[model samples]
Target: MLSDIRPAIVSTILFTVLLGLVYPLAITGVAKLAFPYQAEGSLVRDSAGHVVGSALLAQPFAKDEYLHPRPSAAGNGYDPTSSGGSNYGPLSADLAKRIKGDAAALRQSTGHVQIPDDAITTSASGLDPDISPQYALLQVDRIAKARGAAADEVRALIQRNIQSPLFGFIGQPRVNVLMTNRALDLALPKGQPKRA
Candidate 1:
């Protein structure tokens, strides 16, 4: 009995140290060394050198002069602490109602252009920073009009910021809303109010 209990206790302690502590630390170290920018949360900064937001997480942009990210369901929308989908089923009435409302509003704003699904749907994490290139293009006219810039210039900006798929294959092309908004600010200098 003593032998069995002693070995079991020893194994628990050894495994705890190895798996719980050493493994995590080792992986973190390797990640930090190998992918320093990503390991540090991919934070974006402003012109004044202050941290603005992360390149990886979505933040809301309601004003007309900037591109909006996908609708967030995270606590009050885009709250990192509450990142998650609404979990509405495909047949759910509530989901359909919301999508209909969003689509209607988007059509009214963007002159009835083809609506991309990403423009109306919340991402699984509810905090995806990237929107489809099509969705970003949809907002170009609105943003350009608001900023009092030419549509072609704004379209060019969006085109320049379109990120390619990871390793050119793993994911779809996306436009990071925060990065592009920052670029919009830099390129147009609209003096728009800052958002989180």
Candidate 2:
């Protein structure tokens, strides 16, 4: 019995060290060495070299001058640590109410009677970093007017910033919210600083 227990304990310790510790460390090391930028969270920077945000999560922008991300089911909106969906069933009254409220808010803010569902709906992961291209275009007018820039210019900026789907088909095309906003800031008209 003593011999049996000793071998079992020793094997458990060895497996834990190898599988739990060594394997993870090795994988992490290789990832860092091969893809340092991605392994470090894909942080974005501003023209001033200040770290602004990550490409992985959305950031809220309630003002009219900036394009907005998809509605987040996270706390308040876009809370990274609280990443999750609203969990409302398709037939849930609560979901309907929320969508209606969001639509109304978008209409009021942008003065556009027709609101895209993507503008008001939260993605399943609650960390969506993109809006539908239609949704982004819809806000172009409002954002351009608010920023006192030509609509065409803003549209051009959006077009330039659009990211294609991974491997051409794995997922939908997306605009990384933080990267887009950073570009906006960098491309701001000579006199104006990009507003938050």
Candidate 3:
């Protein structure tokens, strides 16, 4: 009995240290060294060297000039740390109400009555970094108008910035909201411009 208890205790202690502390530290160290940018949270910076946000998570943009990410059920929209979907089932009345409210608000904000499902629905993780291409395009008119840029020019920029699905078929096509907004800032005419 004594021998059995002693070996069990020793093995448990050894495995805990090896798996819990040592293994995690080793992997983290290797990842930091090999993939510094990603290991550091894949943060994006502006030309002025200001930290904007991480490429991994989406941020909320209420202004019509910026493309908005999917509606987040987290704290305020797009709260990364509080990542989670609303978890409302299809027949849930709360889901219906939220979608209706979102669609109405989007129409009012952009003055574009056509709302995509992506615009009205939240992603499962609540940290989706991309919006459907259609949703991104919906904002082009509003943003172009706000910036006094031609719709065609904004459309071109959106096209240029669009990223295809991983492996060309894994997930749906999406446009990164942060990248699109940053490009908009840079793509608008430098001097006086004509509005469409």
Task: Give the lDDT of residue 164 in candidate 3.
Answer: 91
Candidate that would win on lDDT: 1
The reply for model 1, stretches above 4 Å from the true place, is 29-35, 191-196
lDDT of each: 0.91, 0.81, 0.83
Q: What's the lDDT for residue 191 in model 2? A: 48
Off by over 4 Å in 2: 1-8, 47-50, 194-196
Model 1 agreement with the true structure over 1-196: per-residue lDDT tens digits: 7779989999999999999999999999999999988988998876677887899999988989999999999988999999999899999999999999999999999995689989999999989999999999999889998999999999999999998988999989999999899889888866556542
Error of 1 at 150 (Å): 1.0
What is the per-residue lDDT of model 2 for residues 1-196, given as tens digits with 9 covering 90 to 100?
A: 8779988999999999999999999989999999998998887776677777788878887777778899889876788788889989999999999998989888887778887778888898788888877788888888788778888988999889887888999888767666776666567552465433
Q: Rank the candidates by lDDT, best first.
A: 1, 3, 2
Tens-place lDDT per residue, model 3, 112-193, is 8778888889998888889888888888888888777898999999988888989999877888988777777766843544
Question: Where's the lowest-lDDT run of ten residues in candidate 3?
Answer: 187-196
Query: What does candidate 3 score on TM?
Result: 0.88
Which candidate number has the best TM-score? 1
Rank all candidate structures by their TM-score, best first, as comma-separated numbers: 1, 3, 2
Clash counts per candidate, in order, are 0, 0, 0
Name the better of 2 and 3 by lDDT.
3
